[model samples]
Target: MSRTVVFIHGLWIHSVAWQPWQELFAGKGYETHAPGWPGDKDTVAETRLHSEGAGVGVDEITDSYAKFIAGLDSPPIVVGHSFGGLIAQKLLDAGLATAAVAISPAPIKGIKILPLSLLRSSFPVLSRPGNRNKVVPLTEKQFAYGFGNALPPAESAELYERIAIPSPGRPLFEASSANFTKNAPTAVDTTRAGRGPLLLLAADEDHTVPAAVVAAAYRLYASSRARTDIIKYDDRGHSAAFDHGWRQLADDSLAWLDRQSL
Candidate 1:
């Protein structure tokens, strides 16, 4: 059977953004699907009109995907971006995926250092405690700084108009307090020795999930006997998953999968 691949998108961007990546993997002889998070509408415009994902938290999103995978023919390779990246890691740790790629994943429990830029990128939601139960939307200016900092102004604006949507604030709040919370939703098994190979991708210019944050996450896996690797993309931002340079990142992931013989 052809190996299956699942694409998971992080906050703000819609799952439809993974269309290109899905097609790319399919052309490579892999079955692919990019399902939206629970409560996500069928399209970007519809999702924006009604924030159905409001109040959804980290664990809920992870469990939703986990359930989806359980029904699949086999545990598929997972490719996730932003918060989706964190989910990818969780799935790999739980032995629900054959291999995984996390691009600019949100910080998990045990990540101590919080970069200034990360704080600023998250401030929109974390600025208000009540946001934990509300859906929050980023302004164009905010999106420009957080997700599209490395793109040209027009390109960034265009992407914002196309895919940006209100996202549940609870995940951001959960990740923010992960370092101090017990049984936090953002927690992941960093030391699982028998998990499948995992790849962490970071973009140097990403203000949302700084490359240093990803580096810190990679260090957390030092105790794992399983394969864990990280790659940094120069002059890219969190949008590297959908930006002009996304193909390079996607191809690199495929290359890593090949190397791992997955």
Candidate 2:
């Protein structure tokens, strides 16, 4: 049977963001799929114009991607970034993936550490309680501070223009309230017996999901019988997946996946 890999993008970006990763994995003889969140458009420009992604919540996004995974011939090696990372973990817990890699994942239920940078980065969405049902677009300054701080100004500006889009506030709200809410979509079933091995990848310079947050998440998963590990990049930021060193990150993940025999 042919092995498959599925890539999931985080908030403010579309499936197109994973195109390079898809091509790289495809070159390695793995069939790759990068599915967008429901109502996402093909291009950032179109998605920005439509802002349809803002209407959906985390549950809706996860359900939509779960359905796509179910149609696959075999459970895939799932890889995701930021919010997508949380979704990948959810899918793995649901037994939809053979193995999973979550890079700079959003805070899941039970992950209590929140760095000041993360709080600042998320303020645009969380500051406005009324934004739960509204679309929130990040300003260039916010994007630079949150995701592009590690990159050169020119490259950061280019990336901001190319990949940034409006994101729904509902998911952030759900994640924030997850600890108090029973069975929140942001909650992970870490103890699920058949769940696949998971890798929590982090970037030390990431303003959003900082190393501290990733370490706390790893501790939460440590109680599970399922295999879990972590990899941290000291020089990278939250946007490491799209930064100049992306190929190195991709190659490292491929090596890790090979060890799992996926």
1-262: candidate 2 lDDT, tens digit per residue = 2369999988877778788899999999989999888878888899899967655788998999899988988889889999999999998888888899999999989988878999998999999999998888999889999899989988888888988888888999998889899989898987666788899999999998898898999988877888898999997898899878889789988888888844
Inter-residue clash pairs, candidate 2:
none
TM-score of each: 0.98, 0.97
lDDT of 1 at 200: 96
Per-residue lDDT over 50-94 for candidate 1, one digit per residue giving the tens place of the 0 to 100 score: 868878999999999999998899999999999999999999889
Model 1 per-residue lDDT at 8 = 95
Question: So what's the TM-score on candidate 2?
Answer: 0.97
lDDT (C-alpha) at residue 116 in model 1: 93
